[model samples]
Target chain A: MEEAKEGFEPKIIGFTCNWCTYAGADLAGTSRKKYPPNIRIIRLMCSGRLDPMFVLKVLLNGADGVFIGGCHPGECHYIKGNFYARRRIAALRTILKQFGLDDRVRSEWISASEGDKFARVMKEMAEDIKKLGPNPMRDKIL
Target chain B: MKGTELKQEDLEGLFKGLLDKKAVDCLVLPHKVGNNVAYMLVKDGDKIESPAASAIFAPSFGVNAANIVKGWTIPERVGIVAKPCEIRAAIELIKLKQMDKESVLLISADCSGAFTNQDYADHAGEIGDWVDSAKINELKGKGIAIREACAICENRLADVGDIIIERVDGGKVLVAGITDMGDEALSSTELSLEDKDVERQAEKEKIAADAKKEKEELPKMSSVEELEEFLRDCIACKNCRDMCPVCYCKECFFEQPLGKPVGGDLLNLAELRSAIGVPTNQLLYHLTRIYHVCTTCVGCGACEDACPKDIPLTRLYPLIAKKVQEIFEYVPGEDAEEPLPFITYEEEELEDKLR
Candidate 1:
């Protein structure tokens, strides 16, 4: 495995839904689960509220990676919010793939009860991103 | 379905008849304006007889006509004669409630492709009376070619219009009514209609296959650096957004004052990036615009035409739209009753696409 740079810790932006992933993240904290402290979380009411533009903005502004956590399929607090999110994110990923930034963005379905899963995903993502190095956009002016 | 075969010379009379018979209060068709063809709203029957009017079959494309008649609710039934792409855009707009379906009649024809406005203006006189049969290869032989978007457009013939006009051999055209409104309008014209099925399926399929080959051969961008280089000349004029028929937002987010940073905020952005590009947010603007219209873009190429930088936007937006539409199994403007992929979703679909 390629080792990360000597002191380069990846900067990740996490968008978590209030009803599920946010609470799950809270659970991870209260339970004292150990994970990397690289992510800055922004809570939204539902996954559907997350526009593809939000991901593009952070990535273009030099975010090393983006993590989107939503309710599991059929378990959305707003009926079909996560289902809609699935399609939007998939479409966004296709666009991202064209720019070779697809791997930098990840989406997952973590329920409020899955505190361990949340912590594990964060750890895994941090390790993968560290090896992948910083976002090329970080050096770009656009 | 019934149709009437009329000579090319008789088309003007037929259009005049529509207005004379009160089938439509006005006609939204291409008209000769100075040296270029432009969409005009003509209400007078005699105006159709003028030599300066009625260039419906001109090998010219300036703007998507759907944008011309958007939100038309004047209660005057307007008959819009348009190419397949414009018709498709109109269908999408109607579904989005941007247009009232009851107030307009869609008249589409098999497109033989068109030259950009600049190209047409430069070669209009040389291209005389051969638009209906101007094949791309043949035009190229004459030292001219159609726009890249038109050359590879698979939807050259639309099956969703209220009325369709098909050009046949022997200088004659077949006009068919695909809907009851079209049928009623045709019956009122007093032109005898007979059972005639337009059989250009083989021809359409050939064009489609050729288009598929062209699409596969298009240059692709696989990195942000490449994309930035490709858009290096962009001035952020937003002409592409302005010409876009589907970008119907009255107040675009990119144009909002809040989105434009100044003074301390601008300095902070520069500091965070170590440096910032002048005329900032070009990438953000384009990415957001593409994502916003990816679902509804009809690939009309108006944005490509309107671009002052000649950015080859058609190579990006339409190509991405094709992939995005395929993922959702949705074709924009294919059917008026079909819901947009963004507005509606199935309970169980695209599971593999999402991880």
Candidate 2:
């Protein structure tokens, strides 16, 4: 592992659900919450729409971290969308462990009212990614 | 319940009895037609001969037989003899509602393993009227091997069959009635049966365990680069999807115009990304298919068998599917009555799968 260069900022991609996590991030902004701006948030209508390939593509393309945010279980706006997403995430995590990038991926349930929690999570994730240094995939020759 | 002990040569007699007693109006079995052995629909008991018996114990169009049975909805019961994997496949198709179960009598035979069609021809110069297990084993061990899928097969004993013919001590075979339908079918014949449980289970488990360990130790493609390189030889012929028994979609999602890009779409996609692969969605195609078949795939290795490029699709798709199956604690085709993993959901299930 290499040390993070001075003033080095990690690039993180977050797939957030429009109904919950997206609003939570919005709330965090209005609340004057301070958090790392490393993540480039991609808003989807439902967390279930976050295909496993999206995470895989970003990770393979050298994204330092890939975070997925959705509604809590049984509280999905689409009734059962979050449940399906949960299953897919579990399978993906197990698969990524074998790829040596399981630590690079994480998912959480953030309600719209949990602005403080959202800001805290982003800060924590950004720090974790910084310590992890640049994604090794960025240096691959393939 | 007890079972009848019979000579290996008496399988043909059993089939004849099933047909003669009207247990089944039509019997679907593997028969030698000219040079190629295939599963044929036989109505006449007289036509059930030596080749059918040999082909039953040996692998002969068994998976395809499952697919064939899946399409048929007959009023008269048809007796179909398939190997363990083939029987499991049929049970899956039935669960998918593609096949009607009441119209067919599922018969399974304990299989040591069988060679592929081409391998049998190349290796066994003469597959005589009597297909001997000792001879097959000798050929299987010498240079030429069984099909990769067959070699690593976990379930060679028919676990879902109503009637089973298994190997016993001293070159004898046990033809037993496992279910009510099986016992009734057995009672129709003059062949005496003792309702004893079949042996060879321990042996089958050992073989399966050894195969599973070997498969686990095989090199797997983890990174996207490795997967792309692993599938580099693929010409996108889709012979794998076509031959897969679990892939029963009448209009495949990939085959629709959506997956194939038109001229403008191709140019736009390429321009957006600066550059793109010519045959787009090659990776997407494989991933979507493996995901779709994760719950239903029986690991029969039919896809690899059908691959013209020899992509080792079983190694790629079914292995991942097997992992997914484990996460759900769902074994495809283990029980026909059990619902598919994807369609059914538990409220608090997959708790560990999510954050």
TM-score of chain B, candidate 1? 0.93
Over the stretch B1-355, how does candidate 2's per-residue lDDT look in tens digits?
5469888778889889988998888888887655446788899999887845566665433245677776666678888887777777777888887777677778877766666676665544554433344655666567655556666667777666678877666657788877777778888877787758655668778878967875776688766567778878877778888888888888887677666677887787667666666566676678667766777877777788788887877677667777888888987777677987756677787666554
Model 1 lDDT per residue over B149-263, tens place: 8766888874667888776788677888888888888888999999888777898898889888878888989988888898899998999999999988878887776466778
In order, the interface RMSDs are: 1.3, 3.4
The lDDT, on a scale of 0 to 1, for candidate 2 is 0.75
- Give the CAPRI rating of model 1: medium
DockQ scores for all predicted structures: 0.68, 0.33
lDDT (0-100) at residue A15 of candidate 1?
A: 96
lDDT of 1 by residue, A11-95 (tens): 9999999999999999999999989999999999999999889999999988999999999989999999998899899899878
